[model samples]
Target: MRKWLPLIAVCAGSFLFLLDTTVVTVALPRIGADLSASVGQLQWVPDVYTLVLTVLMLAAGSLADRWGPRRTFLAGLVVFGLASLACGFSPDIGMLIAARGVQAIGGAALAVTGFALLVAHYDGRERGTAISVFFAVNGLGAAVGPLAGGVLTEYFGWSAIFFVNVPLVVLTAVFTVFALGRDTPARRGRFDLAGAAWFALGAASLVHGLTLGGEGRWTSPVTVGALVVSVVAFAAFGFVERRPEPLLDLRLFRDGGFTTLVACAAASTLTFAALVYVSLWLQTGRALGPVAAGLELAPLAVASFLTSTLAGRVLHRFPPRVLLGAGVLLGAAGCLLQLGLAVPAGLAVTGIGVGIAGPATGAAIVAAAPPGRAGMAAGILTTTRQFGQTLGVAVLGIAYQAGGLAPVYVVAAGCGGVTGLLALVPRKQARVTT
Candidate 1:
C-alpha cells in the first residue's frame, strides 16, 4: 500500500485537473446568474480553461522535459490551487474567465507530467496496474464532475465548486513532495517559443471568432478580423513548426494512422461539448435545479465509467479500427437519438460509445508512434482532443443560440458520423491493442 503513494499523488492531481474540465458544466447557470454573465461569457468560463490547456499542452510537455516531471507537477499543483482560490473569489464573470485560463496553465503541467511520473516510478506488472488505475481515476473524474458540481452548487453555491479544489491540491502536493524522487532534467533543448506563440494565437482567435459568430456577430468587424487572424496565425504556426526543434513536430502528420487517431480524438469530444448545452437546457429551459439536471445527466457519466472499465478488460480482443469506428458510430447514433425527447437515453448511449473508444484510441496512438516520438504523439493527441472540445463548445453554442437543442444535436451527430467513418478507413500501420 505504501509503495503506491506516488501513483496516488499523481492520480489525485490528474483527477482534479480533469474534473475541472466538466465540473463547471452543471454550475454554469448559477454562475451566469450570480455573475450577471451573458451566454458568451458563460461559454468562456469552460472554454478558456480548455483552450489555454490545449494550446499550452505541448509546451508544458517540453517544460517537463527541461524541469523534470516531479518539479513541474508540484509547481502545477501550486498554480492550480492559487487559481482556484481566485476563481472562488471572483467578483464578476470576466475575473472568473481570466482565473480559469490561469488554472489551465497549471492543468497543462499536471496533464503532461502525470504519465511521465508514473512511467518513471513503476515497471512491468506494477506499471501496468498503475496505468490502469490512473486511467480509471481520470474516467471517474469526468463521470463524477457534473454530479459533484450539482451537489456542491445546490447546497453551497457555485463558488464552492472552485473552492473545493484548494484542500485537494494541498493534500496532493504534500504526498507528491514525499513520495516522488528528486528531479533530473532530461533535455536541454531550446523551447519553441515561436511555435507556441503562433499556435496559441491561432487557436484562441479561432475560438473567439466562433463565439462572436455564435452571439450573432458574424458580420461584425471584430468577428471578421478574428477569423482572418486565425487563418494567418495557423499558417504561421505551420511555417514555424517546420524548424528543426519545433514545439510540435508537424512531421508526425505524415503517419496516416496518427492523423486518423488524432481526428478521432477530436471527434470524441464533440459530445462532451454538447453536454454543456444539455445541462443548461435542463436547467433554464426545463426548469430543473442544478442537482436535478445533474441527476438527469447521471446516466451518461455512470454508463461511460462502467463501459470504460468493462472495455479496458477486453480491449485487447478487438482491432483498433473496429473499436474506434464502432464506438464513435454508436455515439453518433446516441447523438441522433437526442434529437427527440429522449435526453437521458441518448446521453447514456453517447457515454458508452465514448467509453468504448477512449482506451483503444489512446493505446493505438501511442503504439503507432515512430520510436522516440511517442511523447509528442501523446501530446498532440491530448492537445487535439482539448481543442476539439473547445471548438465543439464554440460551434455548438452557436447552434444553440441560432436554433436550439435540435440543431446542436444534429451538428454533433454529423461530426461524429464523419469522424467515425474516417477512423474506419484502412491504413498501413502495425496492429496495436490496449
Candidate 2:
C-alpha cells in the first residue's frame, strides 16, 4: 500500500496541473467576454504559467535535492491550491494572470519532484511500468481537462473551472501526507542563482519581444530592445553555466541522443500548442459555445490518451529516432489537414502523433541520463517541453495576430515538419537502444 501511495499522490497533482493547461483554452472565450481581455492579455493567461514554470524549472531539481521530494511536493500543493483559489476569485484578467504566475511556481516544483520520487520508488522492470503510467496519466489528464473545463465553464461559469482545483488539491495533499510518509535524506547541491536569473530573464525577454513583434512590427523600439535583452541574457547564461555546479550541466547537450530526446519533447508539445489556437477559432470564428467547442476538441485528448498508453508499452521495442521521427511527421500531416477546417480529425491525428512520441521521449531521457542525476534530467526535459509550448504560443499568437487562424495553422505545420526532420538525424552514443 505504501509503495503505491507516492505514484498516486504524484499523479493526482500532475493531473490537476495538466488539467488546467488545456482546460483554460476552453474558457478563453468566456474570460474574454467577461473581462474584455485583449489578445495579448488572453495569450498571457496561459503563457504566463508556462513562462514562470519554465524559468523556475531550472532550479526545481536543486530544490528537491536540497530539501527532499516529500517536502517539495507538499509545498507545491499548498501554493498551487492557494493560487487556484485566488484565480477562481479573480475579478479581472490582471488578477487571474498574476495568480497564474503563483500557480506556476508550485507547478514547476511538483513536476520535478514528482518524477524524481517516481524514479526513486520503483526500479528494474517495475520502473518502466511506473514511468509509463506517469505519461499515460498525464495524457489522460490532458484528455479529460478540456471536456471538464467545458462542462464547468458552461454550466457553472469560468470561475468554476479554477474553483474545482481546491478540493482536488486538498484531497491529494491529505493522501500524500498520510501515505507517502516522510522525505528521504537530502542531497547537497549549490543553487546557481545567477545562472537561473540569466536564463529566466533571457527566456522571458525573448518571449515578450516575439509576442509583441508578432503583434506589430519587428522594427519597433520596444521589440528591438526586448530582442537585444534576450540575446545578451542568454549569452550570459551560457557563460555562467561553464562554472562548476551550474544549474544545468551544459555537457548534457553534447550527447546527441539526449539532445534528440529533448527535441522530441519540444516538438511534441509544439504540436499540442495548436489545440489552443483551435479552441479559440472554434469559439471566436465559428461562434461555438464553450461546451460545444470542448466537445468538438475532445478527440485530441482521447487520441492522446489511447496512443500514449500503447506507445508506453511498445517503447522498448523501437528506436527513439524511428518512433519520434515518424510520429512527429504524422503530427505534421495532421497540422496540414487542419488547413481545410477538418479540425476534429486533424486534432485526433495530432494527438496520436504527440502521444506516440511523448512516452518514448520521456523514457529515453531518463534512461540516457548519467547515474544519480535522473531528477536533474527530468527537470531539463520538462523545461524544454514548457519552453517549446511557450514558443509555440508566442509564434502562433503572432501569426494569429497578423493573419488569423489559417496562417497560424500553416506555421504550426511548418514547425511539425522541422521537428520530424530533426528526429531522423541519428543521435551519437545511442545508449539504451531497444
Candidate 3:
C-alpha cells in the first residue's frame, strides 16, 4: 500500500504540468481574439509559463538537494493548485499570463524534484521501471492536451482551458497531502542564486526574442536586444556553472553518456514542438479545424508514450548505442516522411513514426545517467529540450508565419534529419549498458 501511494501523487502532478503546456496551443488564437491581445501578448500565454519555469528549475533542484524532495514536492503542489485557480479566474489575458508565470514556478519545483523522490525510495531495475511509468503517464497528459483543449474551447470557451486544470490540480494536491510522508537529507547548501538568476533572465530574454519574431519584423530593436542579451547571458551561465559552488553542476556533462542523453532530450523536445505546428498547419493551412487537425497528429504522441515505457523496460539489457542508433534512423525516416507530408496520409504516417522515437530517446537518456545524478541530468535534458522547442517554434515562425503548413514540415524534417545524423556519430566506448 505504501509503495503504490507515491506513484499516484507524482503521476498526477506530471499529468497536470504537461497537460497545461500542450492544451494551451489550441487556445492561442481564441485567447488573442477574446482578450484583444497583440501578437506579443498572445505569445506570452505560452512564453511566460515556459520562461518562468525554465528559469526556476535549477533553484528547485537545489531545494531538493538541501532540505529534501518530499517537503518541496508537497509545497509545490499547494502553490501550483492556487495558481491554477488564479489562471481560471483571470479577467483578461494579462492576468492569465501573469498567473501562468506563478504556475511555472510551482511546476519547476515539482518536475525538478519529482523523479528524485521516486529514486530515493527505489533502487536498480525498480527505479528504472518507475521512471518509465512516470514518463509514460506524463506523456499521456501531453498527448491528450491539444485534443482536449480544442474540444473545450470550441464547445465551452477559451477560459475552459484553465478551468480544466482545476480538478487535476485539486486531486494532485490532495494526494500529495495525504499519501506522501516526510523525507529529509542531512546534506545541505545555500541556494545558488547567481546561477539560477542567469538561467531565468537568459532564457526569458531568448524566448522573448523568439516569441517577438512571430509578431513583428525580425529587424525590430526589441527582437535584436532580446536576442543579444540571451546570447551573452547564456555564455555567462556556462561559465558560472563551472564555478566551485555552481548552481547547477557543470561537471555532470563530462560523463561519456551524458552528452548523448542531452542530444536525445533536445531532439525529443523538438519533435513535440514540431507536432504543435504541424497540427496547426493541418487545420489552419488545409482548413480542417481543430479536432480534425488534432486527430491527424494523434498517432505521434500515442506511439511515443507506448515506446518510451517499453524501451525503459529493455534498456538495461541493450547497449545504449544500439538504441540511440535505431532512434536516429527512425527519427530520420520520420523526418523524411514529414518532408513528403502534403497530404493527410503523409501526415499520419510521419507523425506515428516520430511518436516511436520518443521512448527510444527516453530509454537511452535514463540508461546513460548515473543514479544519484538523475535529478540534475533530468533538469539538463528538460532544459535542452525546452531550448530546442524554442528554436523549433521560432524557425517554424520564420518560415511560414503566413500559415503554410507544408513549408513548416519541410523545415522540421530538415532539422530532425540533421540532429539524427549527429546522434549516429561513433562513440569511443559505445557499449554503455551492461
Instruction: State TM-scores per candidate.
Output: 0.93, 0.95, 0.88
lDDT of 3 by residue, 278-379 (tens): 655655567766666666666655665666567667767766555655564555456566666534454344434344444445445555544444455456
Q: Which window of 10 residues has the lowest lDDT sum in candidate 3? A: 425-434
Please give the CA lDDT of all the candidate structures: 0.83, 0.81, 0.67
89 Cα displacement, candidate 3 (Å):
2.3
lDDT of 1 by residue, 1-434 (tens): 88899989988998999899999999998898889998777888999999998888888876776778899899999999999999999999989999999999999888878866766677555655565566667666866788899999999999999999999999999989998989776666788899989988999899999989989999999999999999999999999888876677766677676677788878888988888888888888999988888888787777777777666566667678788888788889899988988888988898888787776676675556444343354467568778999999999998998898999999999988998998888876543221
Roughly what TM-score does model 3 have, to 2 decimal places? 0.88
Model 2, 1-434: lDDT tens per residue? 66777788888988888787778988988898899998778889888988888888878876776678788888999999999999999999999999999998988888888888887788866666677678778877766677888899999999999899999999999988886767773456577899989999999999889888877768999999999999999999999999976777778777776776677688777665767887788888888888888898788778887787677567777887878887788788788877887877988888888788777777777777656665676788779888988888888887777787888778877877887888888767434321
Ordering by lDDT = 1, 2, 3
Colliding pairs, model 1: none
Over 4 Å off, model 2: 430-434
**Candidate 3: stretches off by over 4 Å:** 214-216, 255-257, 342-374, 428-434
Best-fitting candidate, measured by TM-score? 2
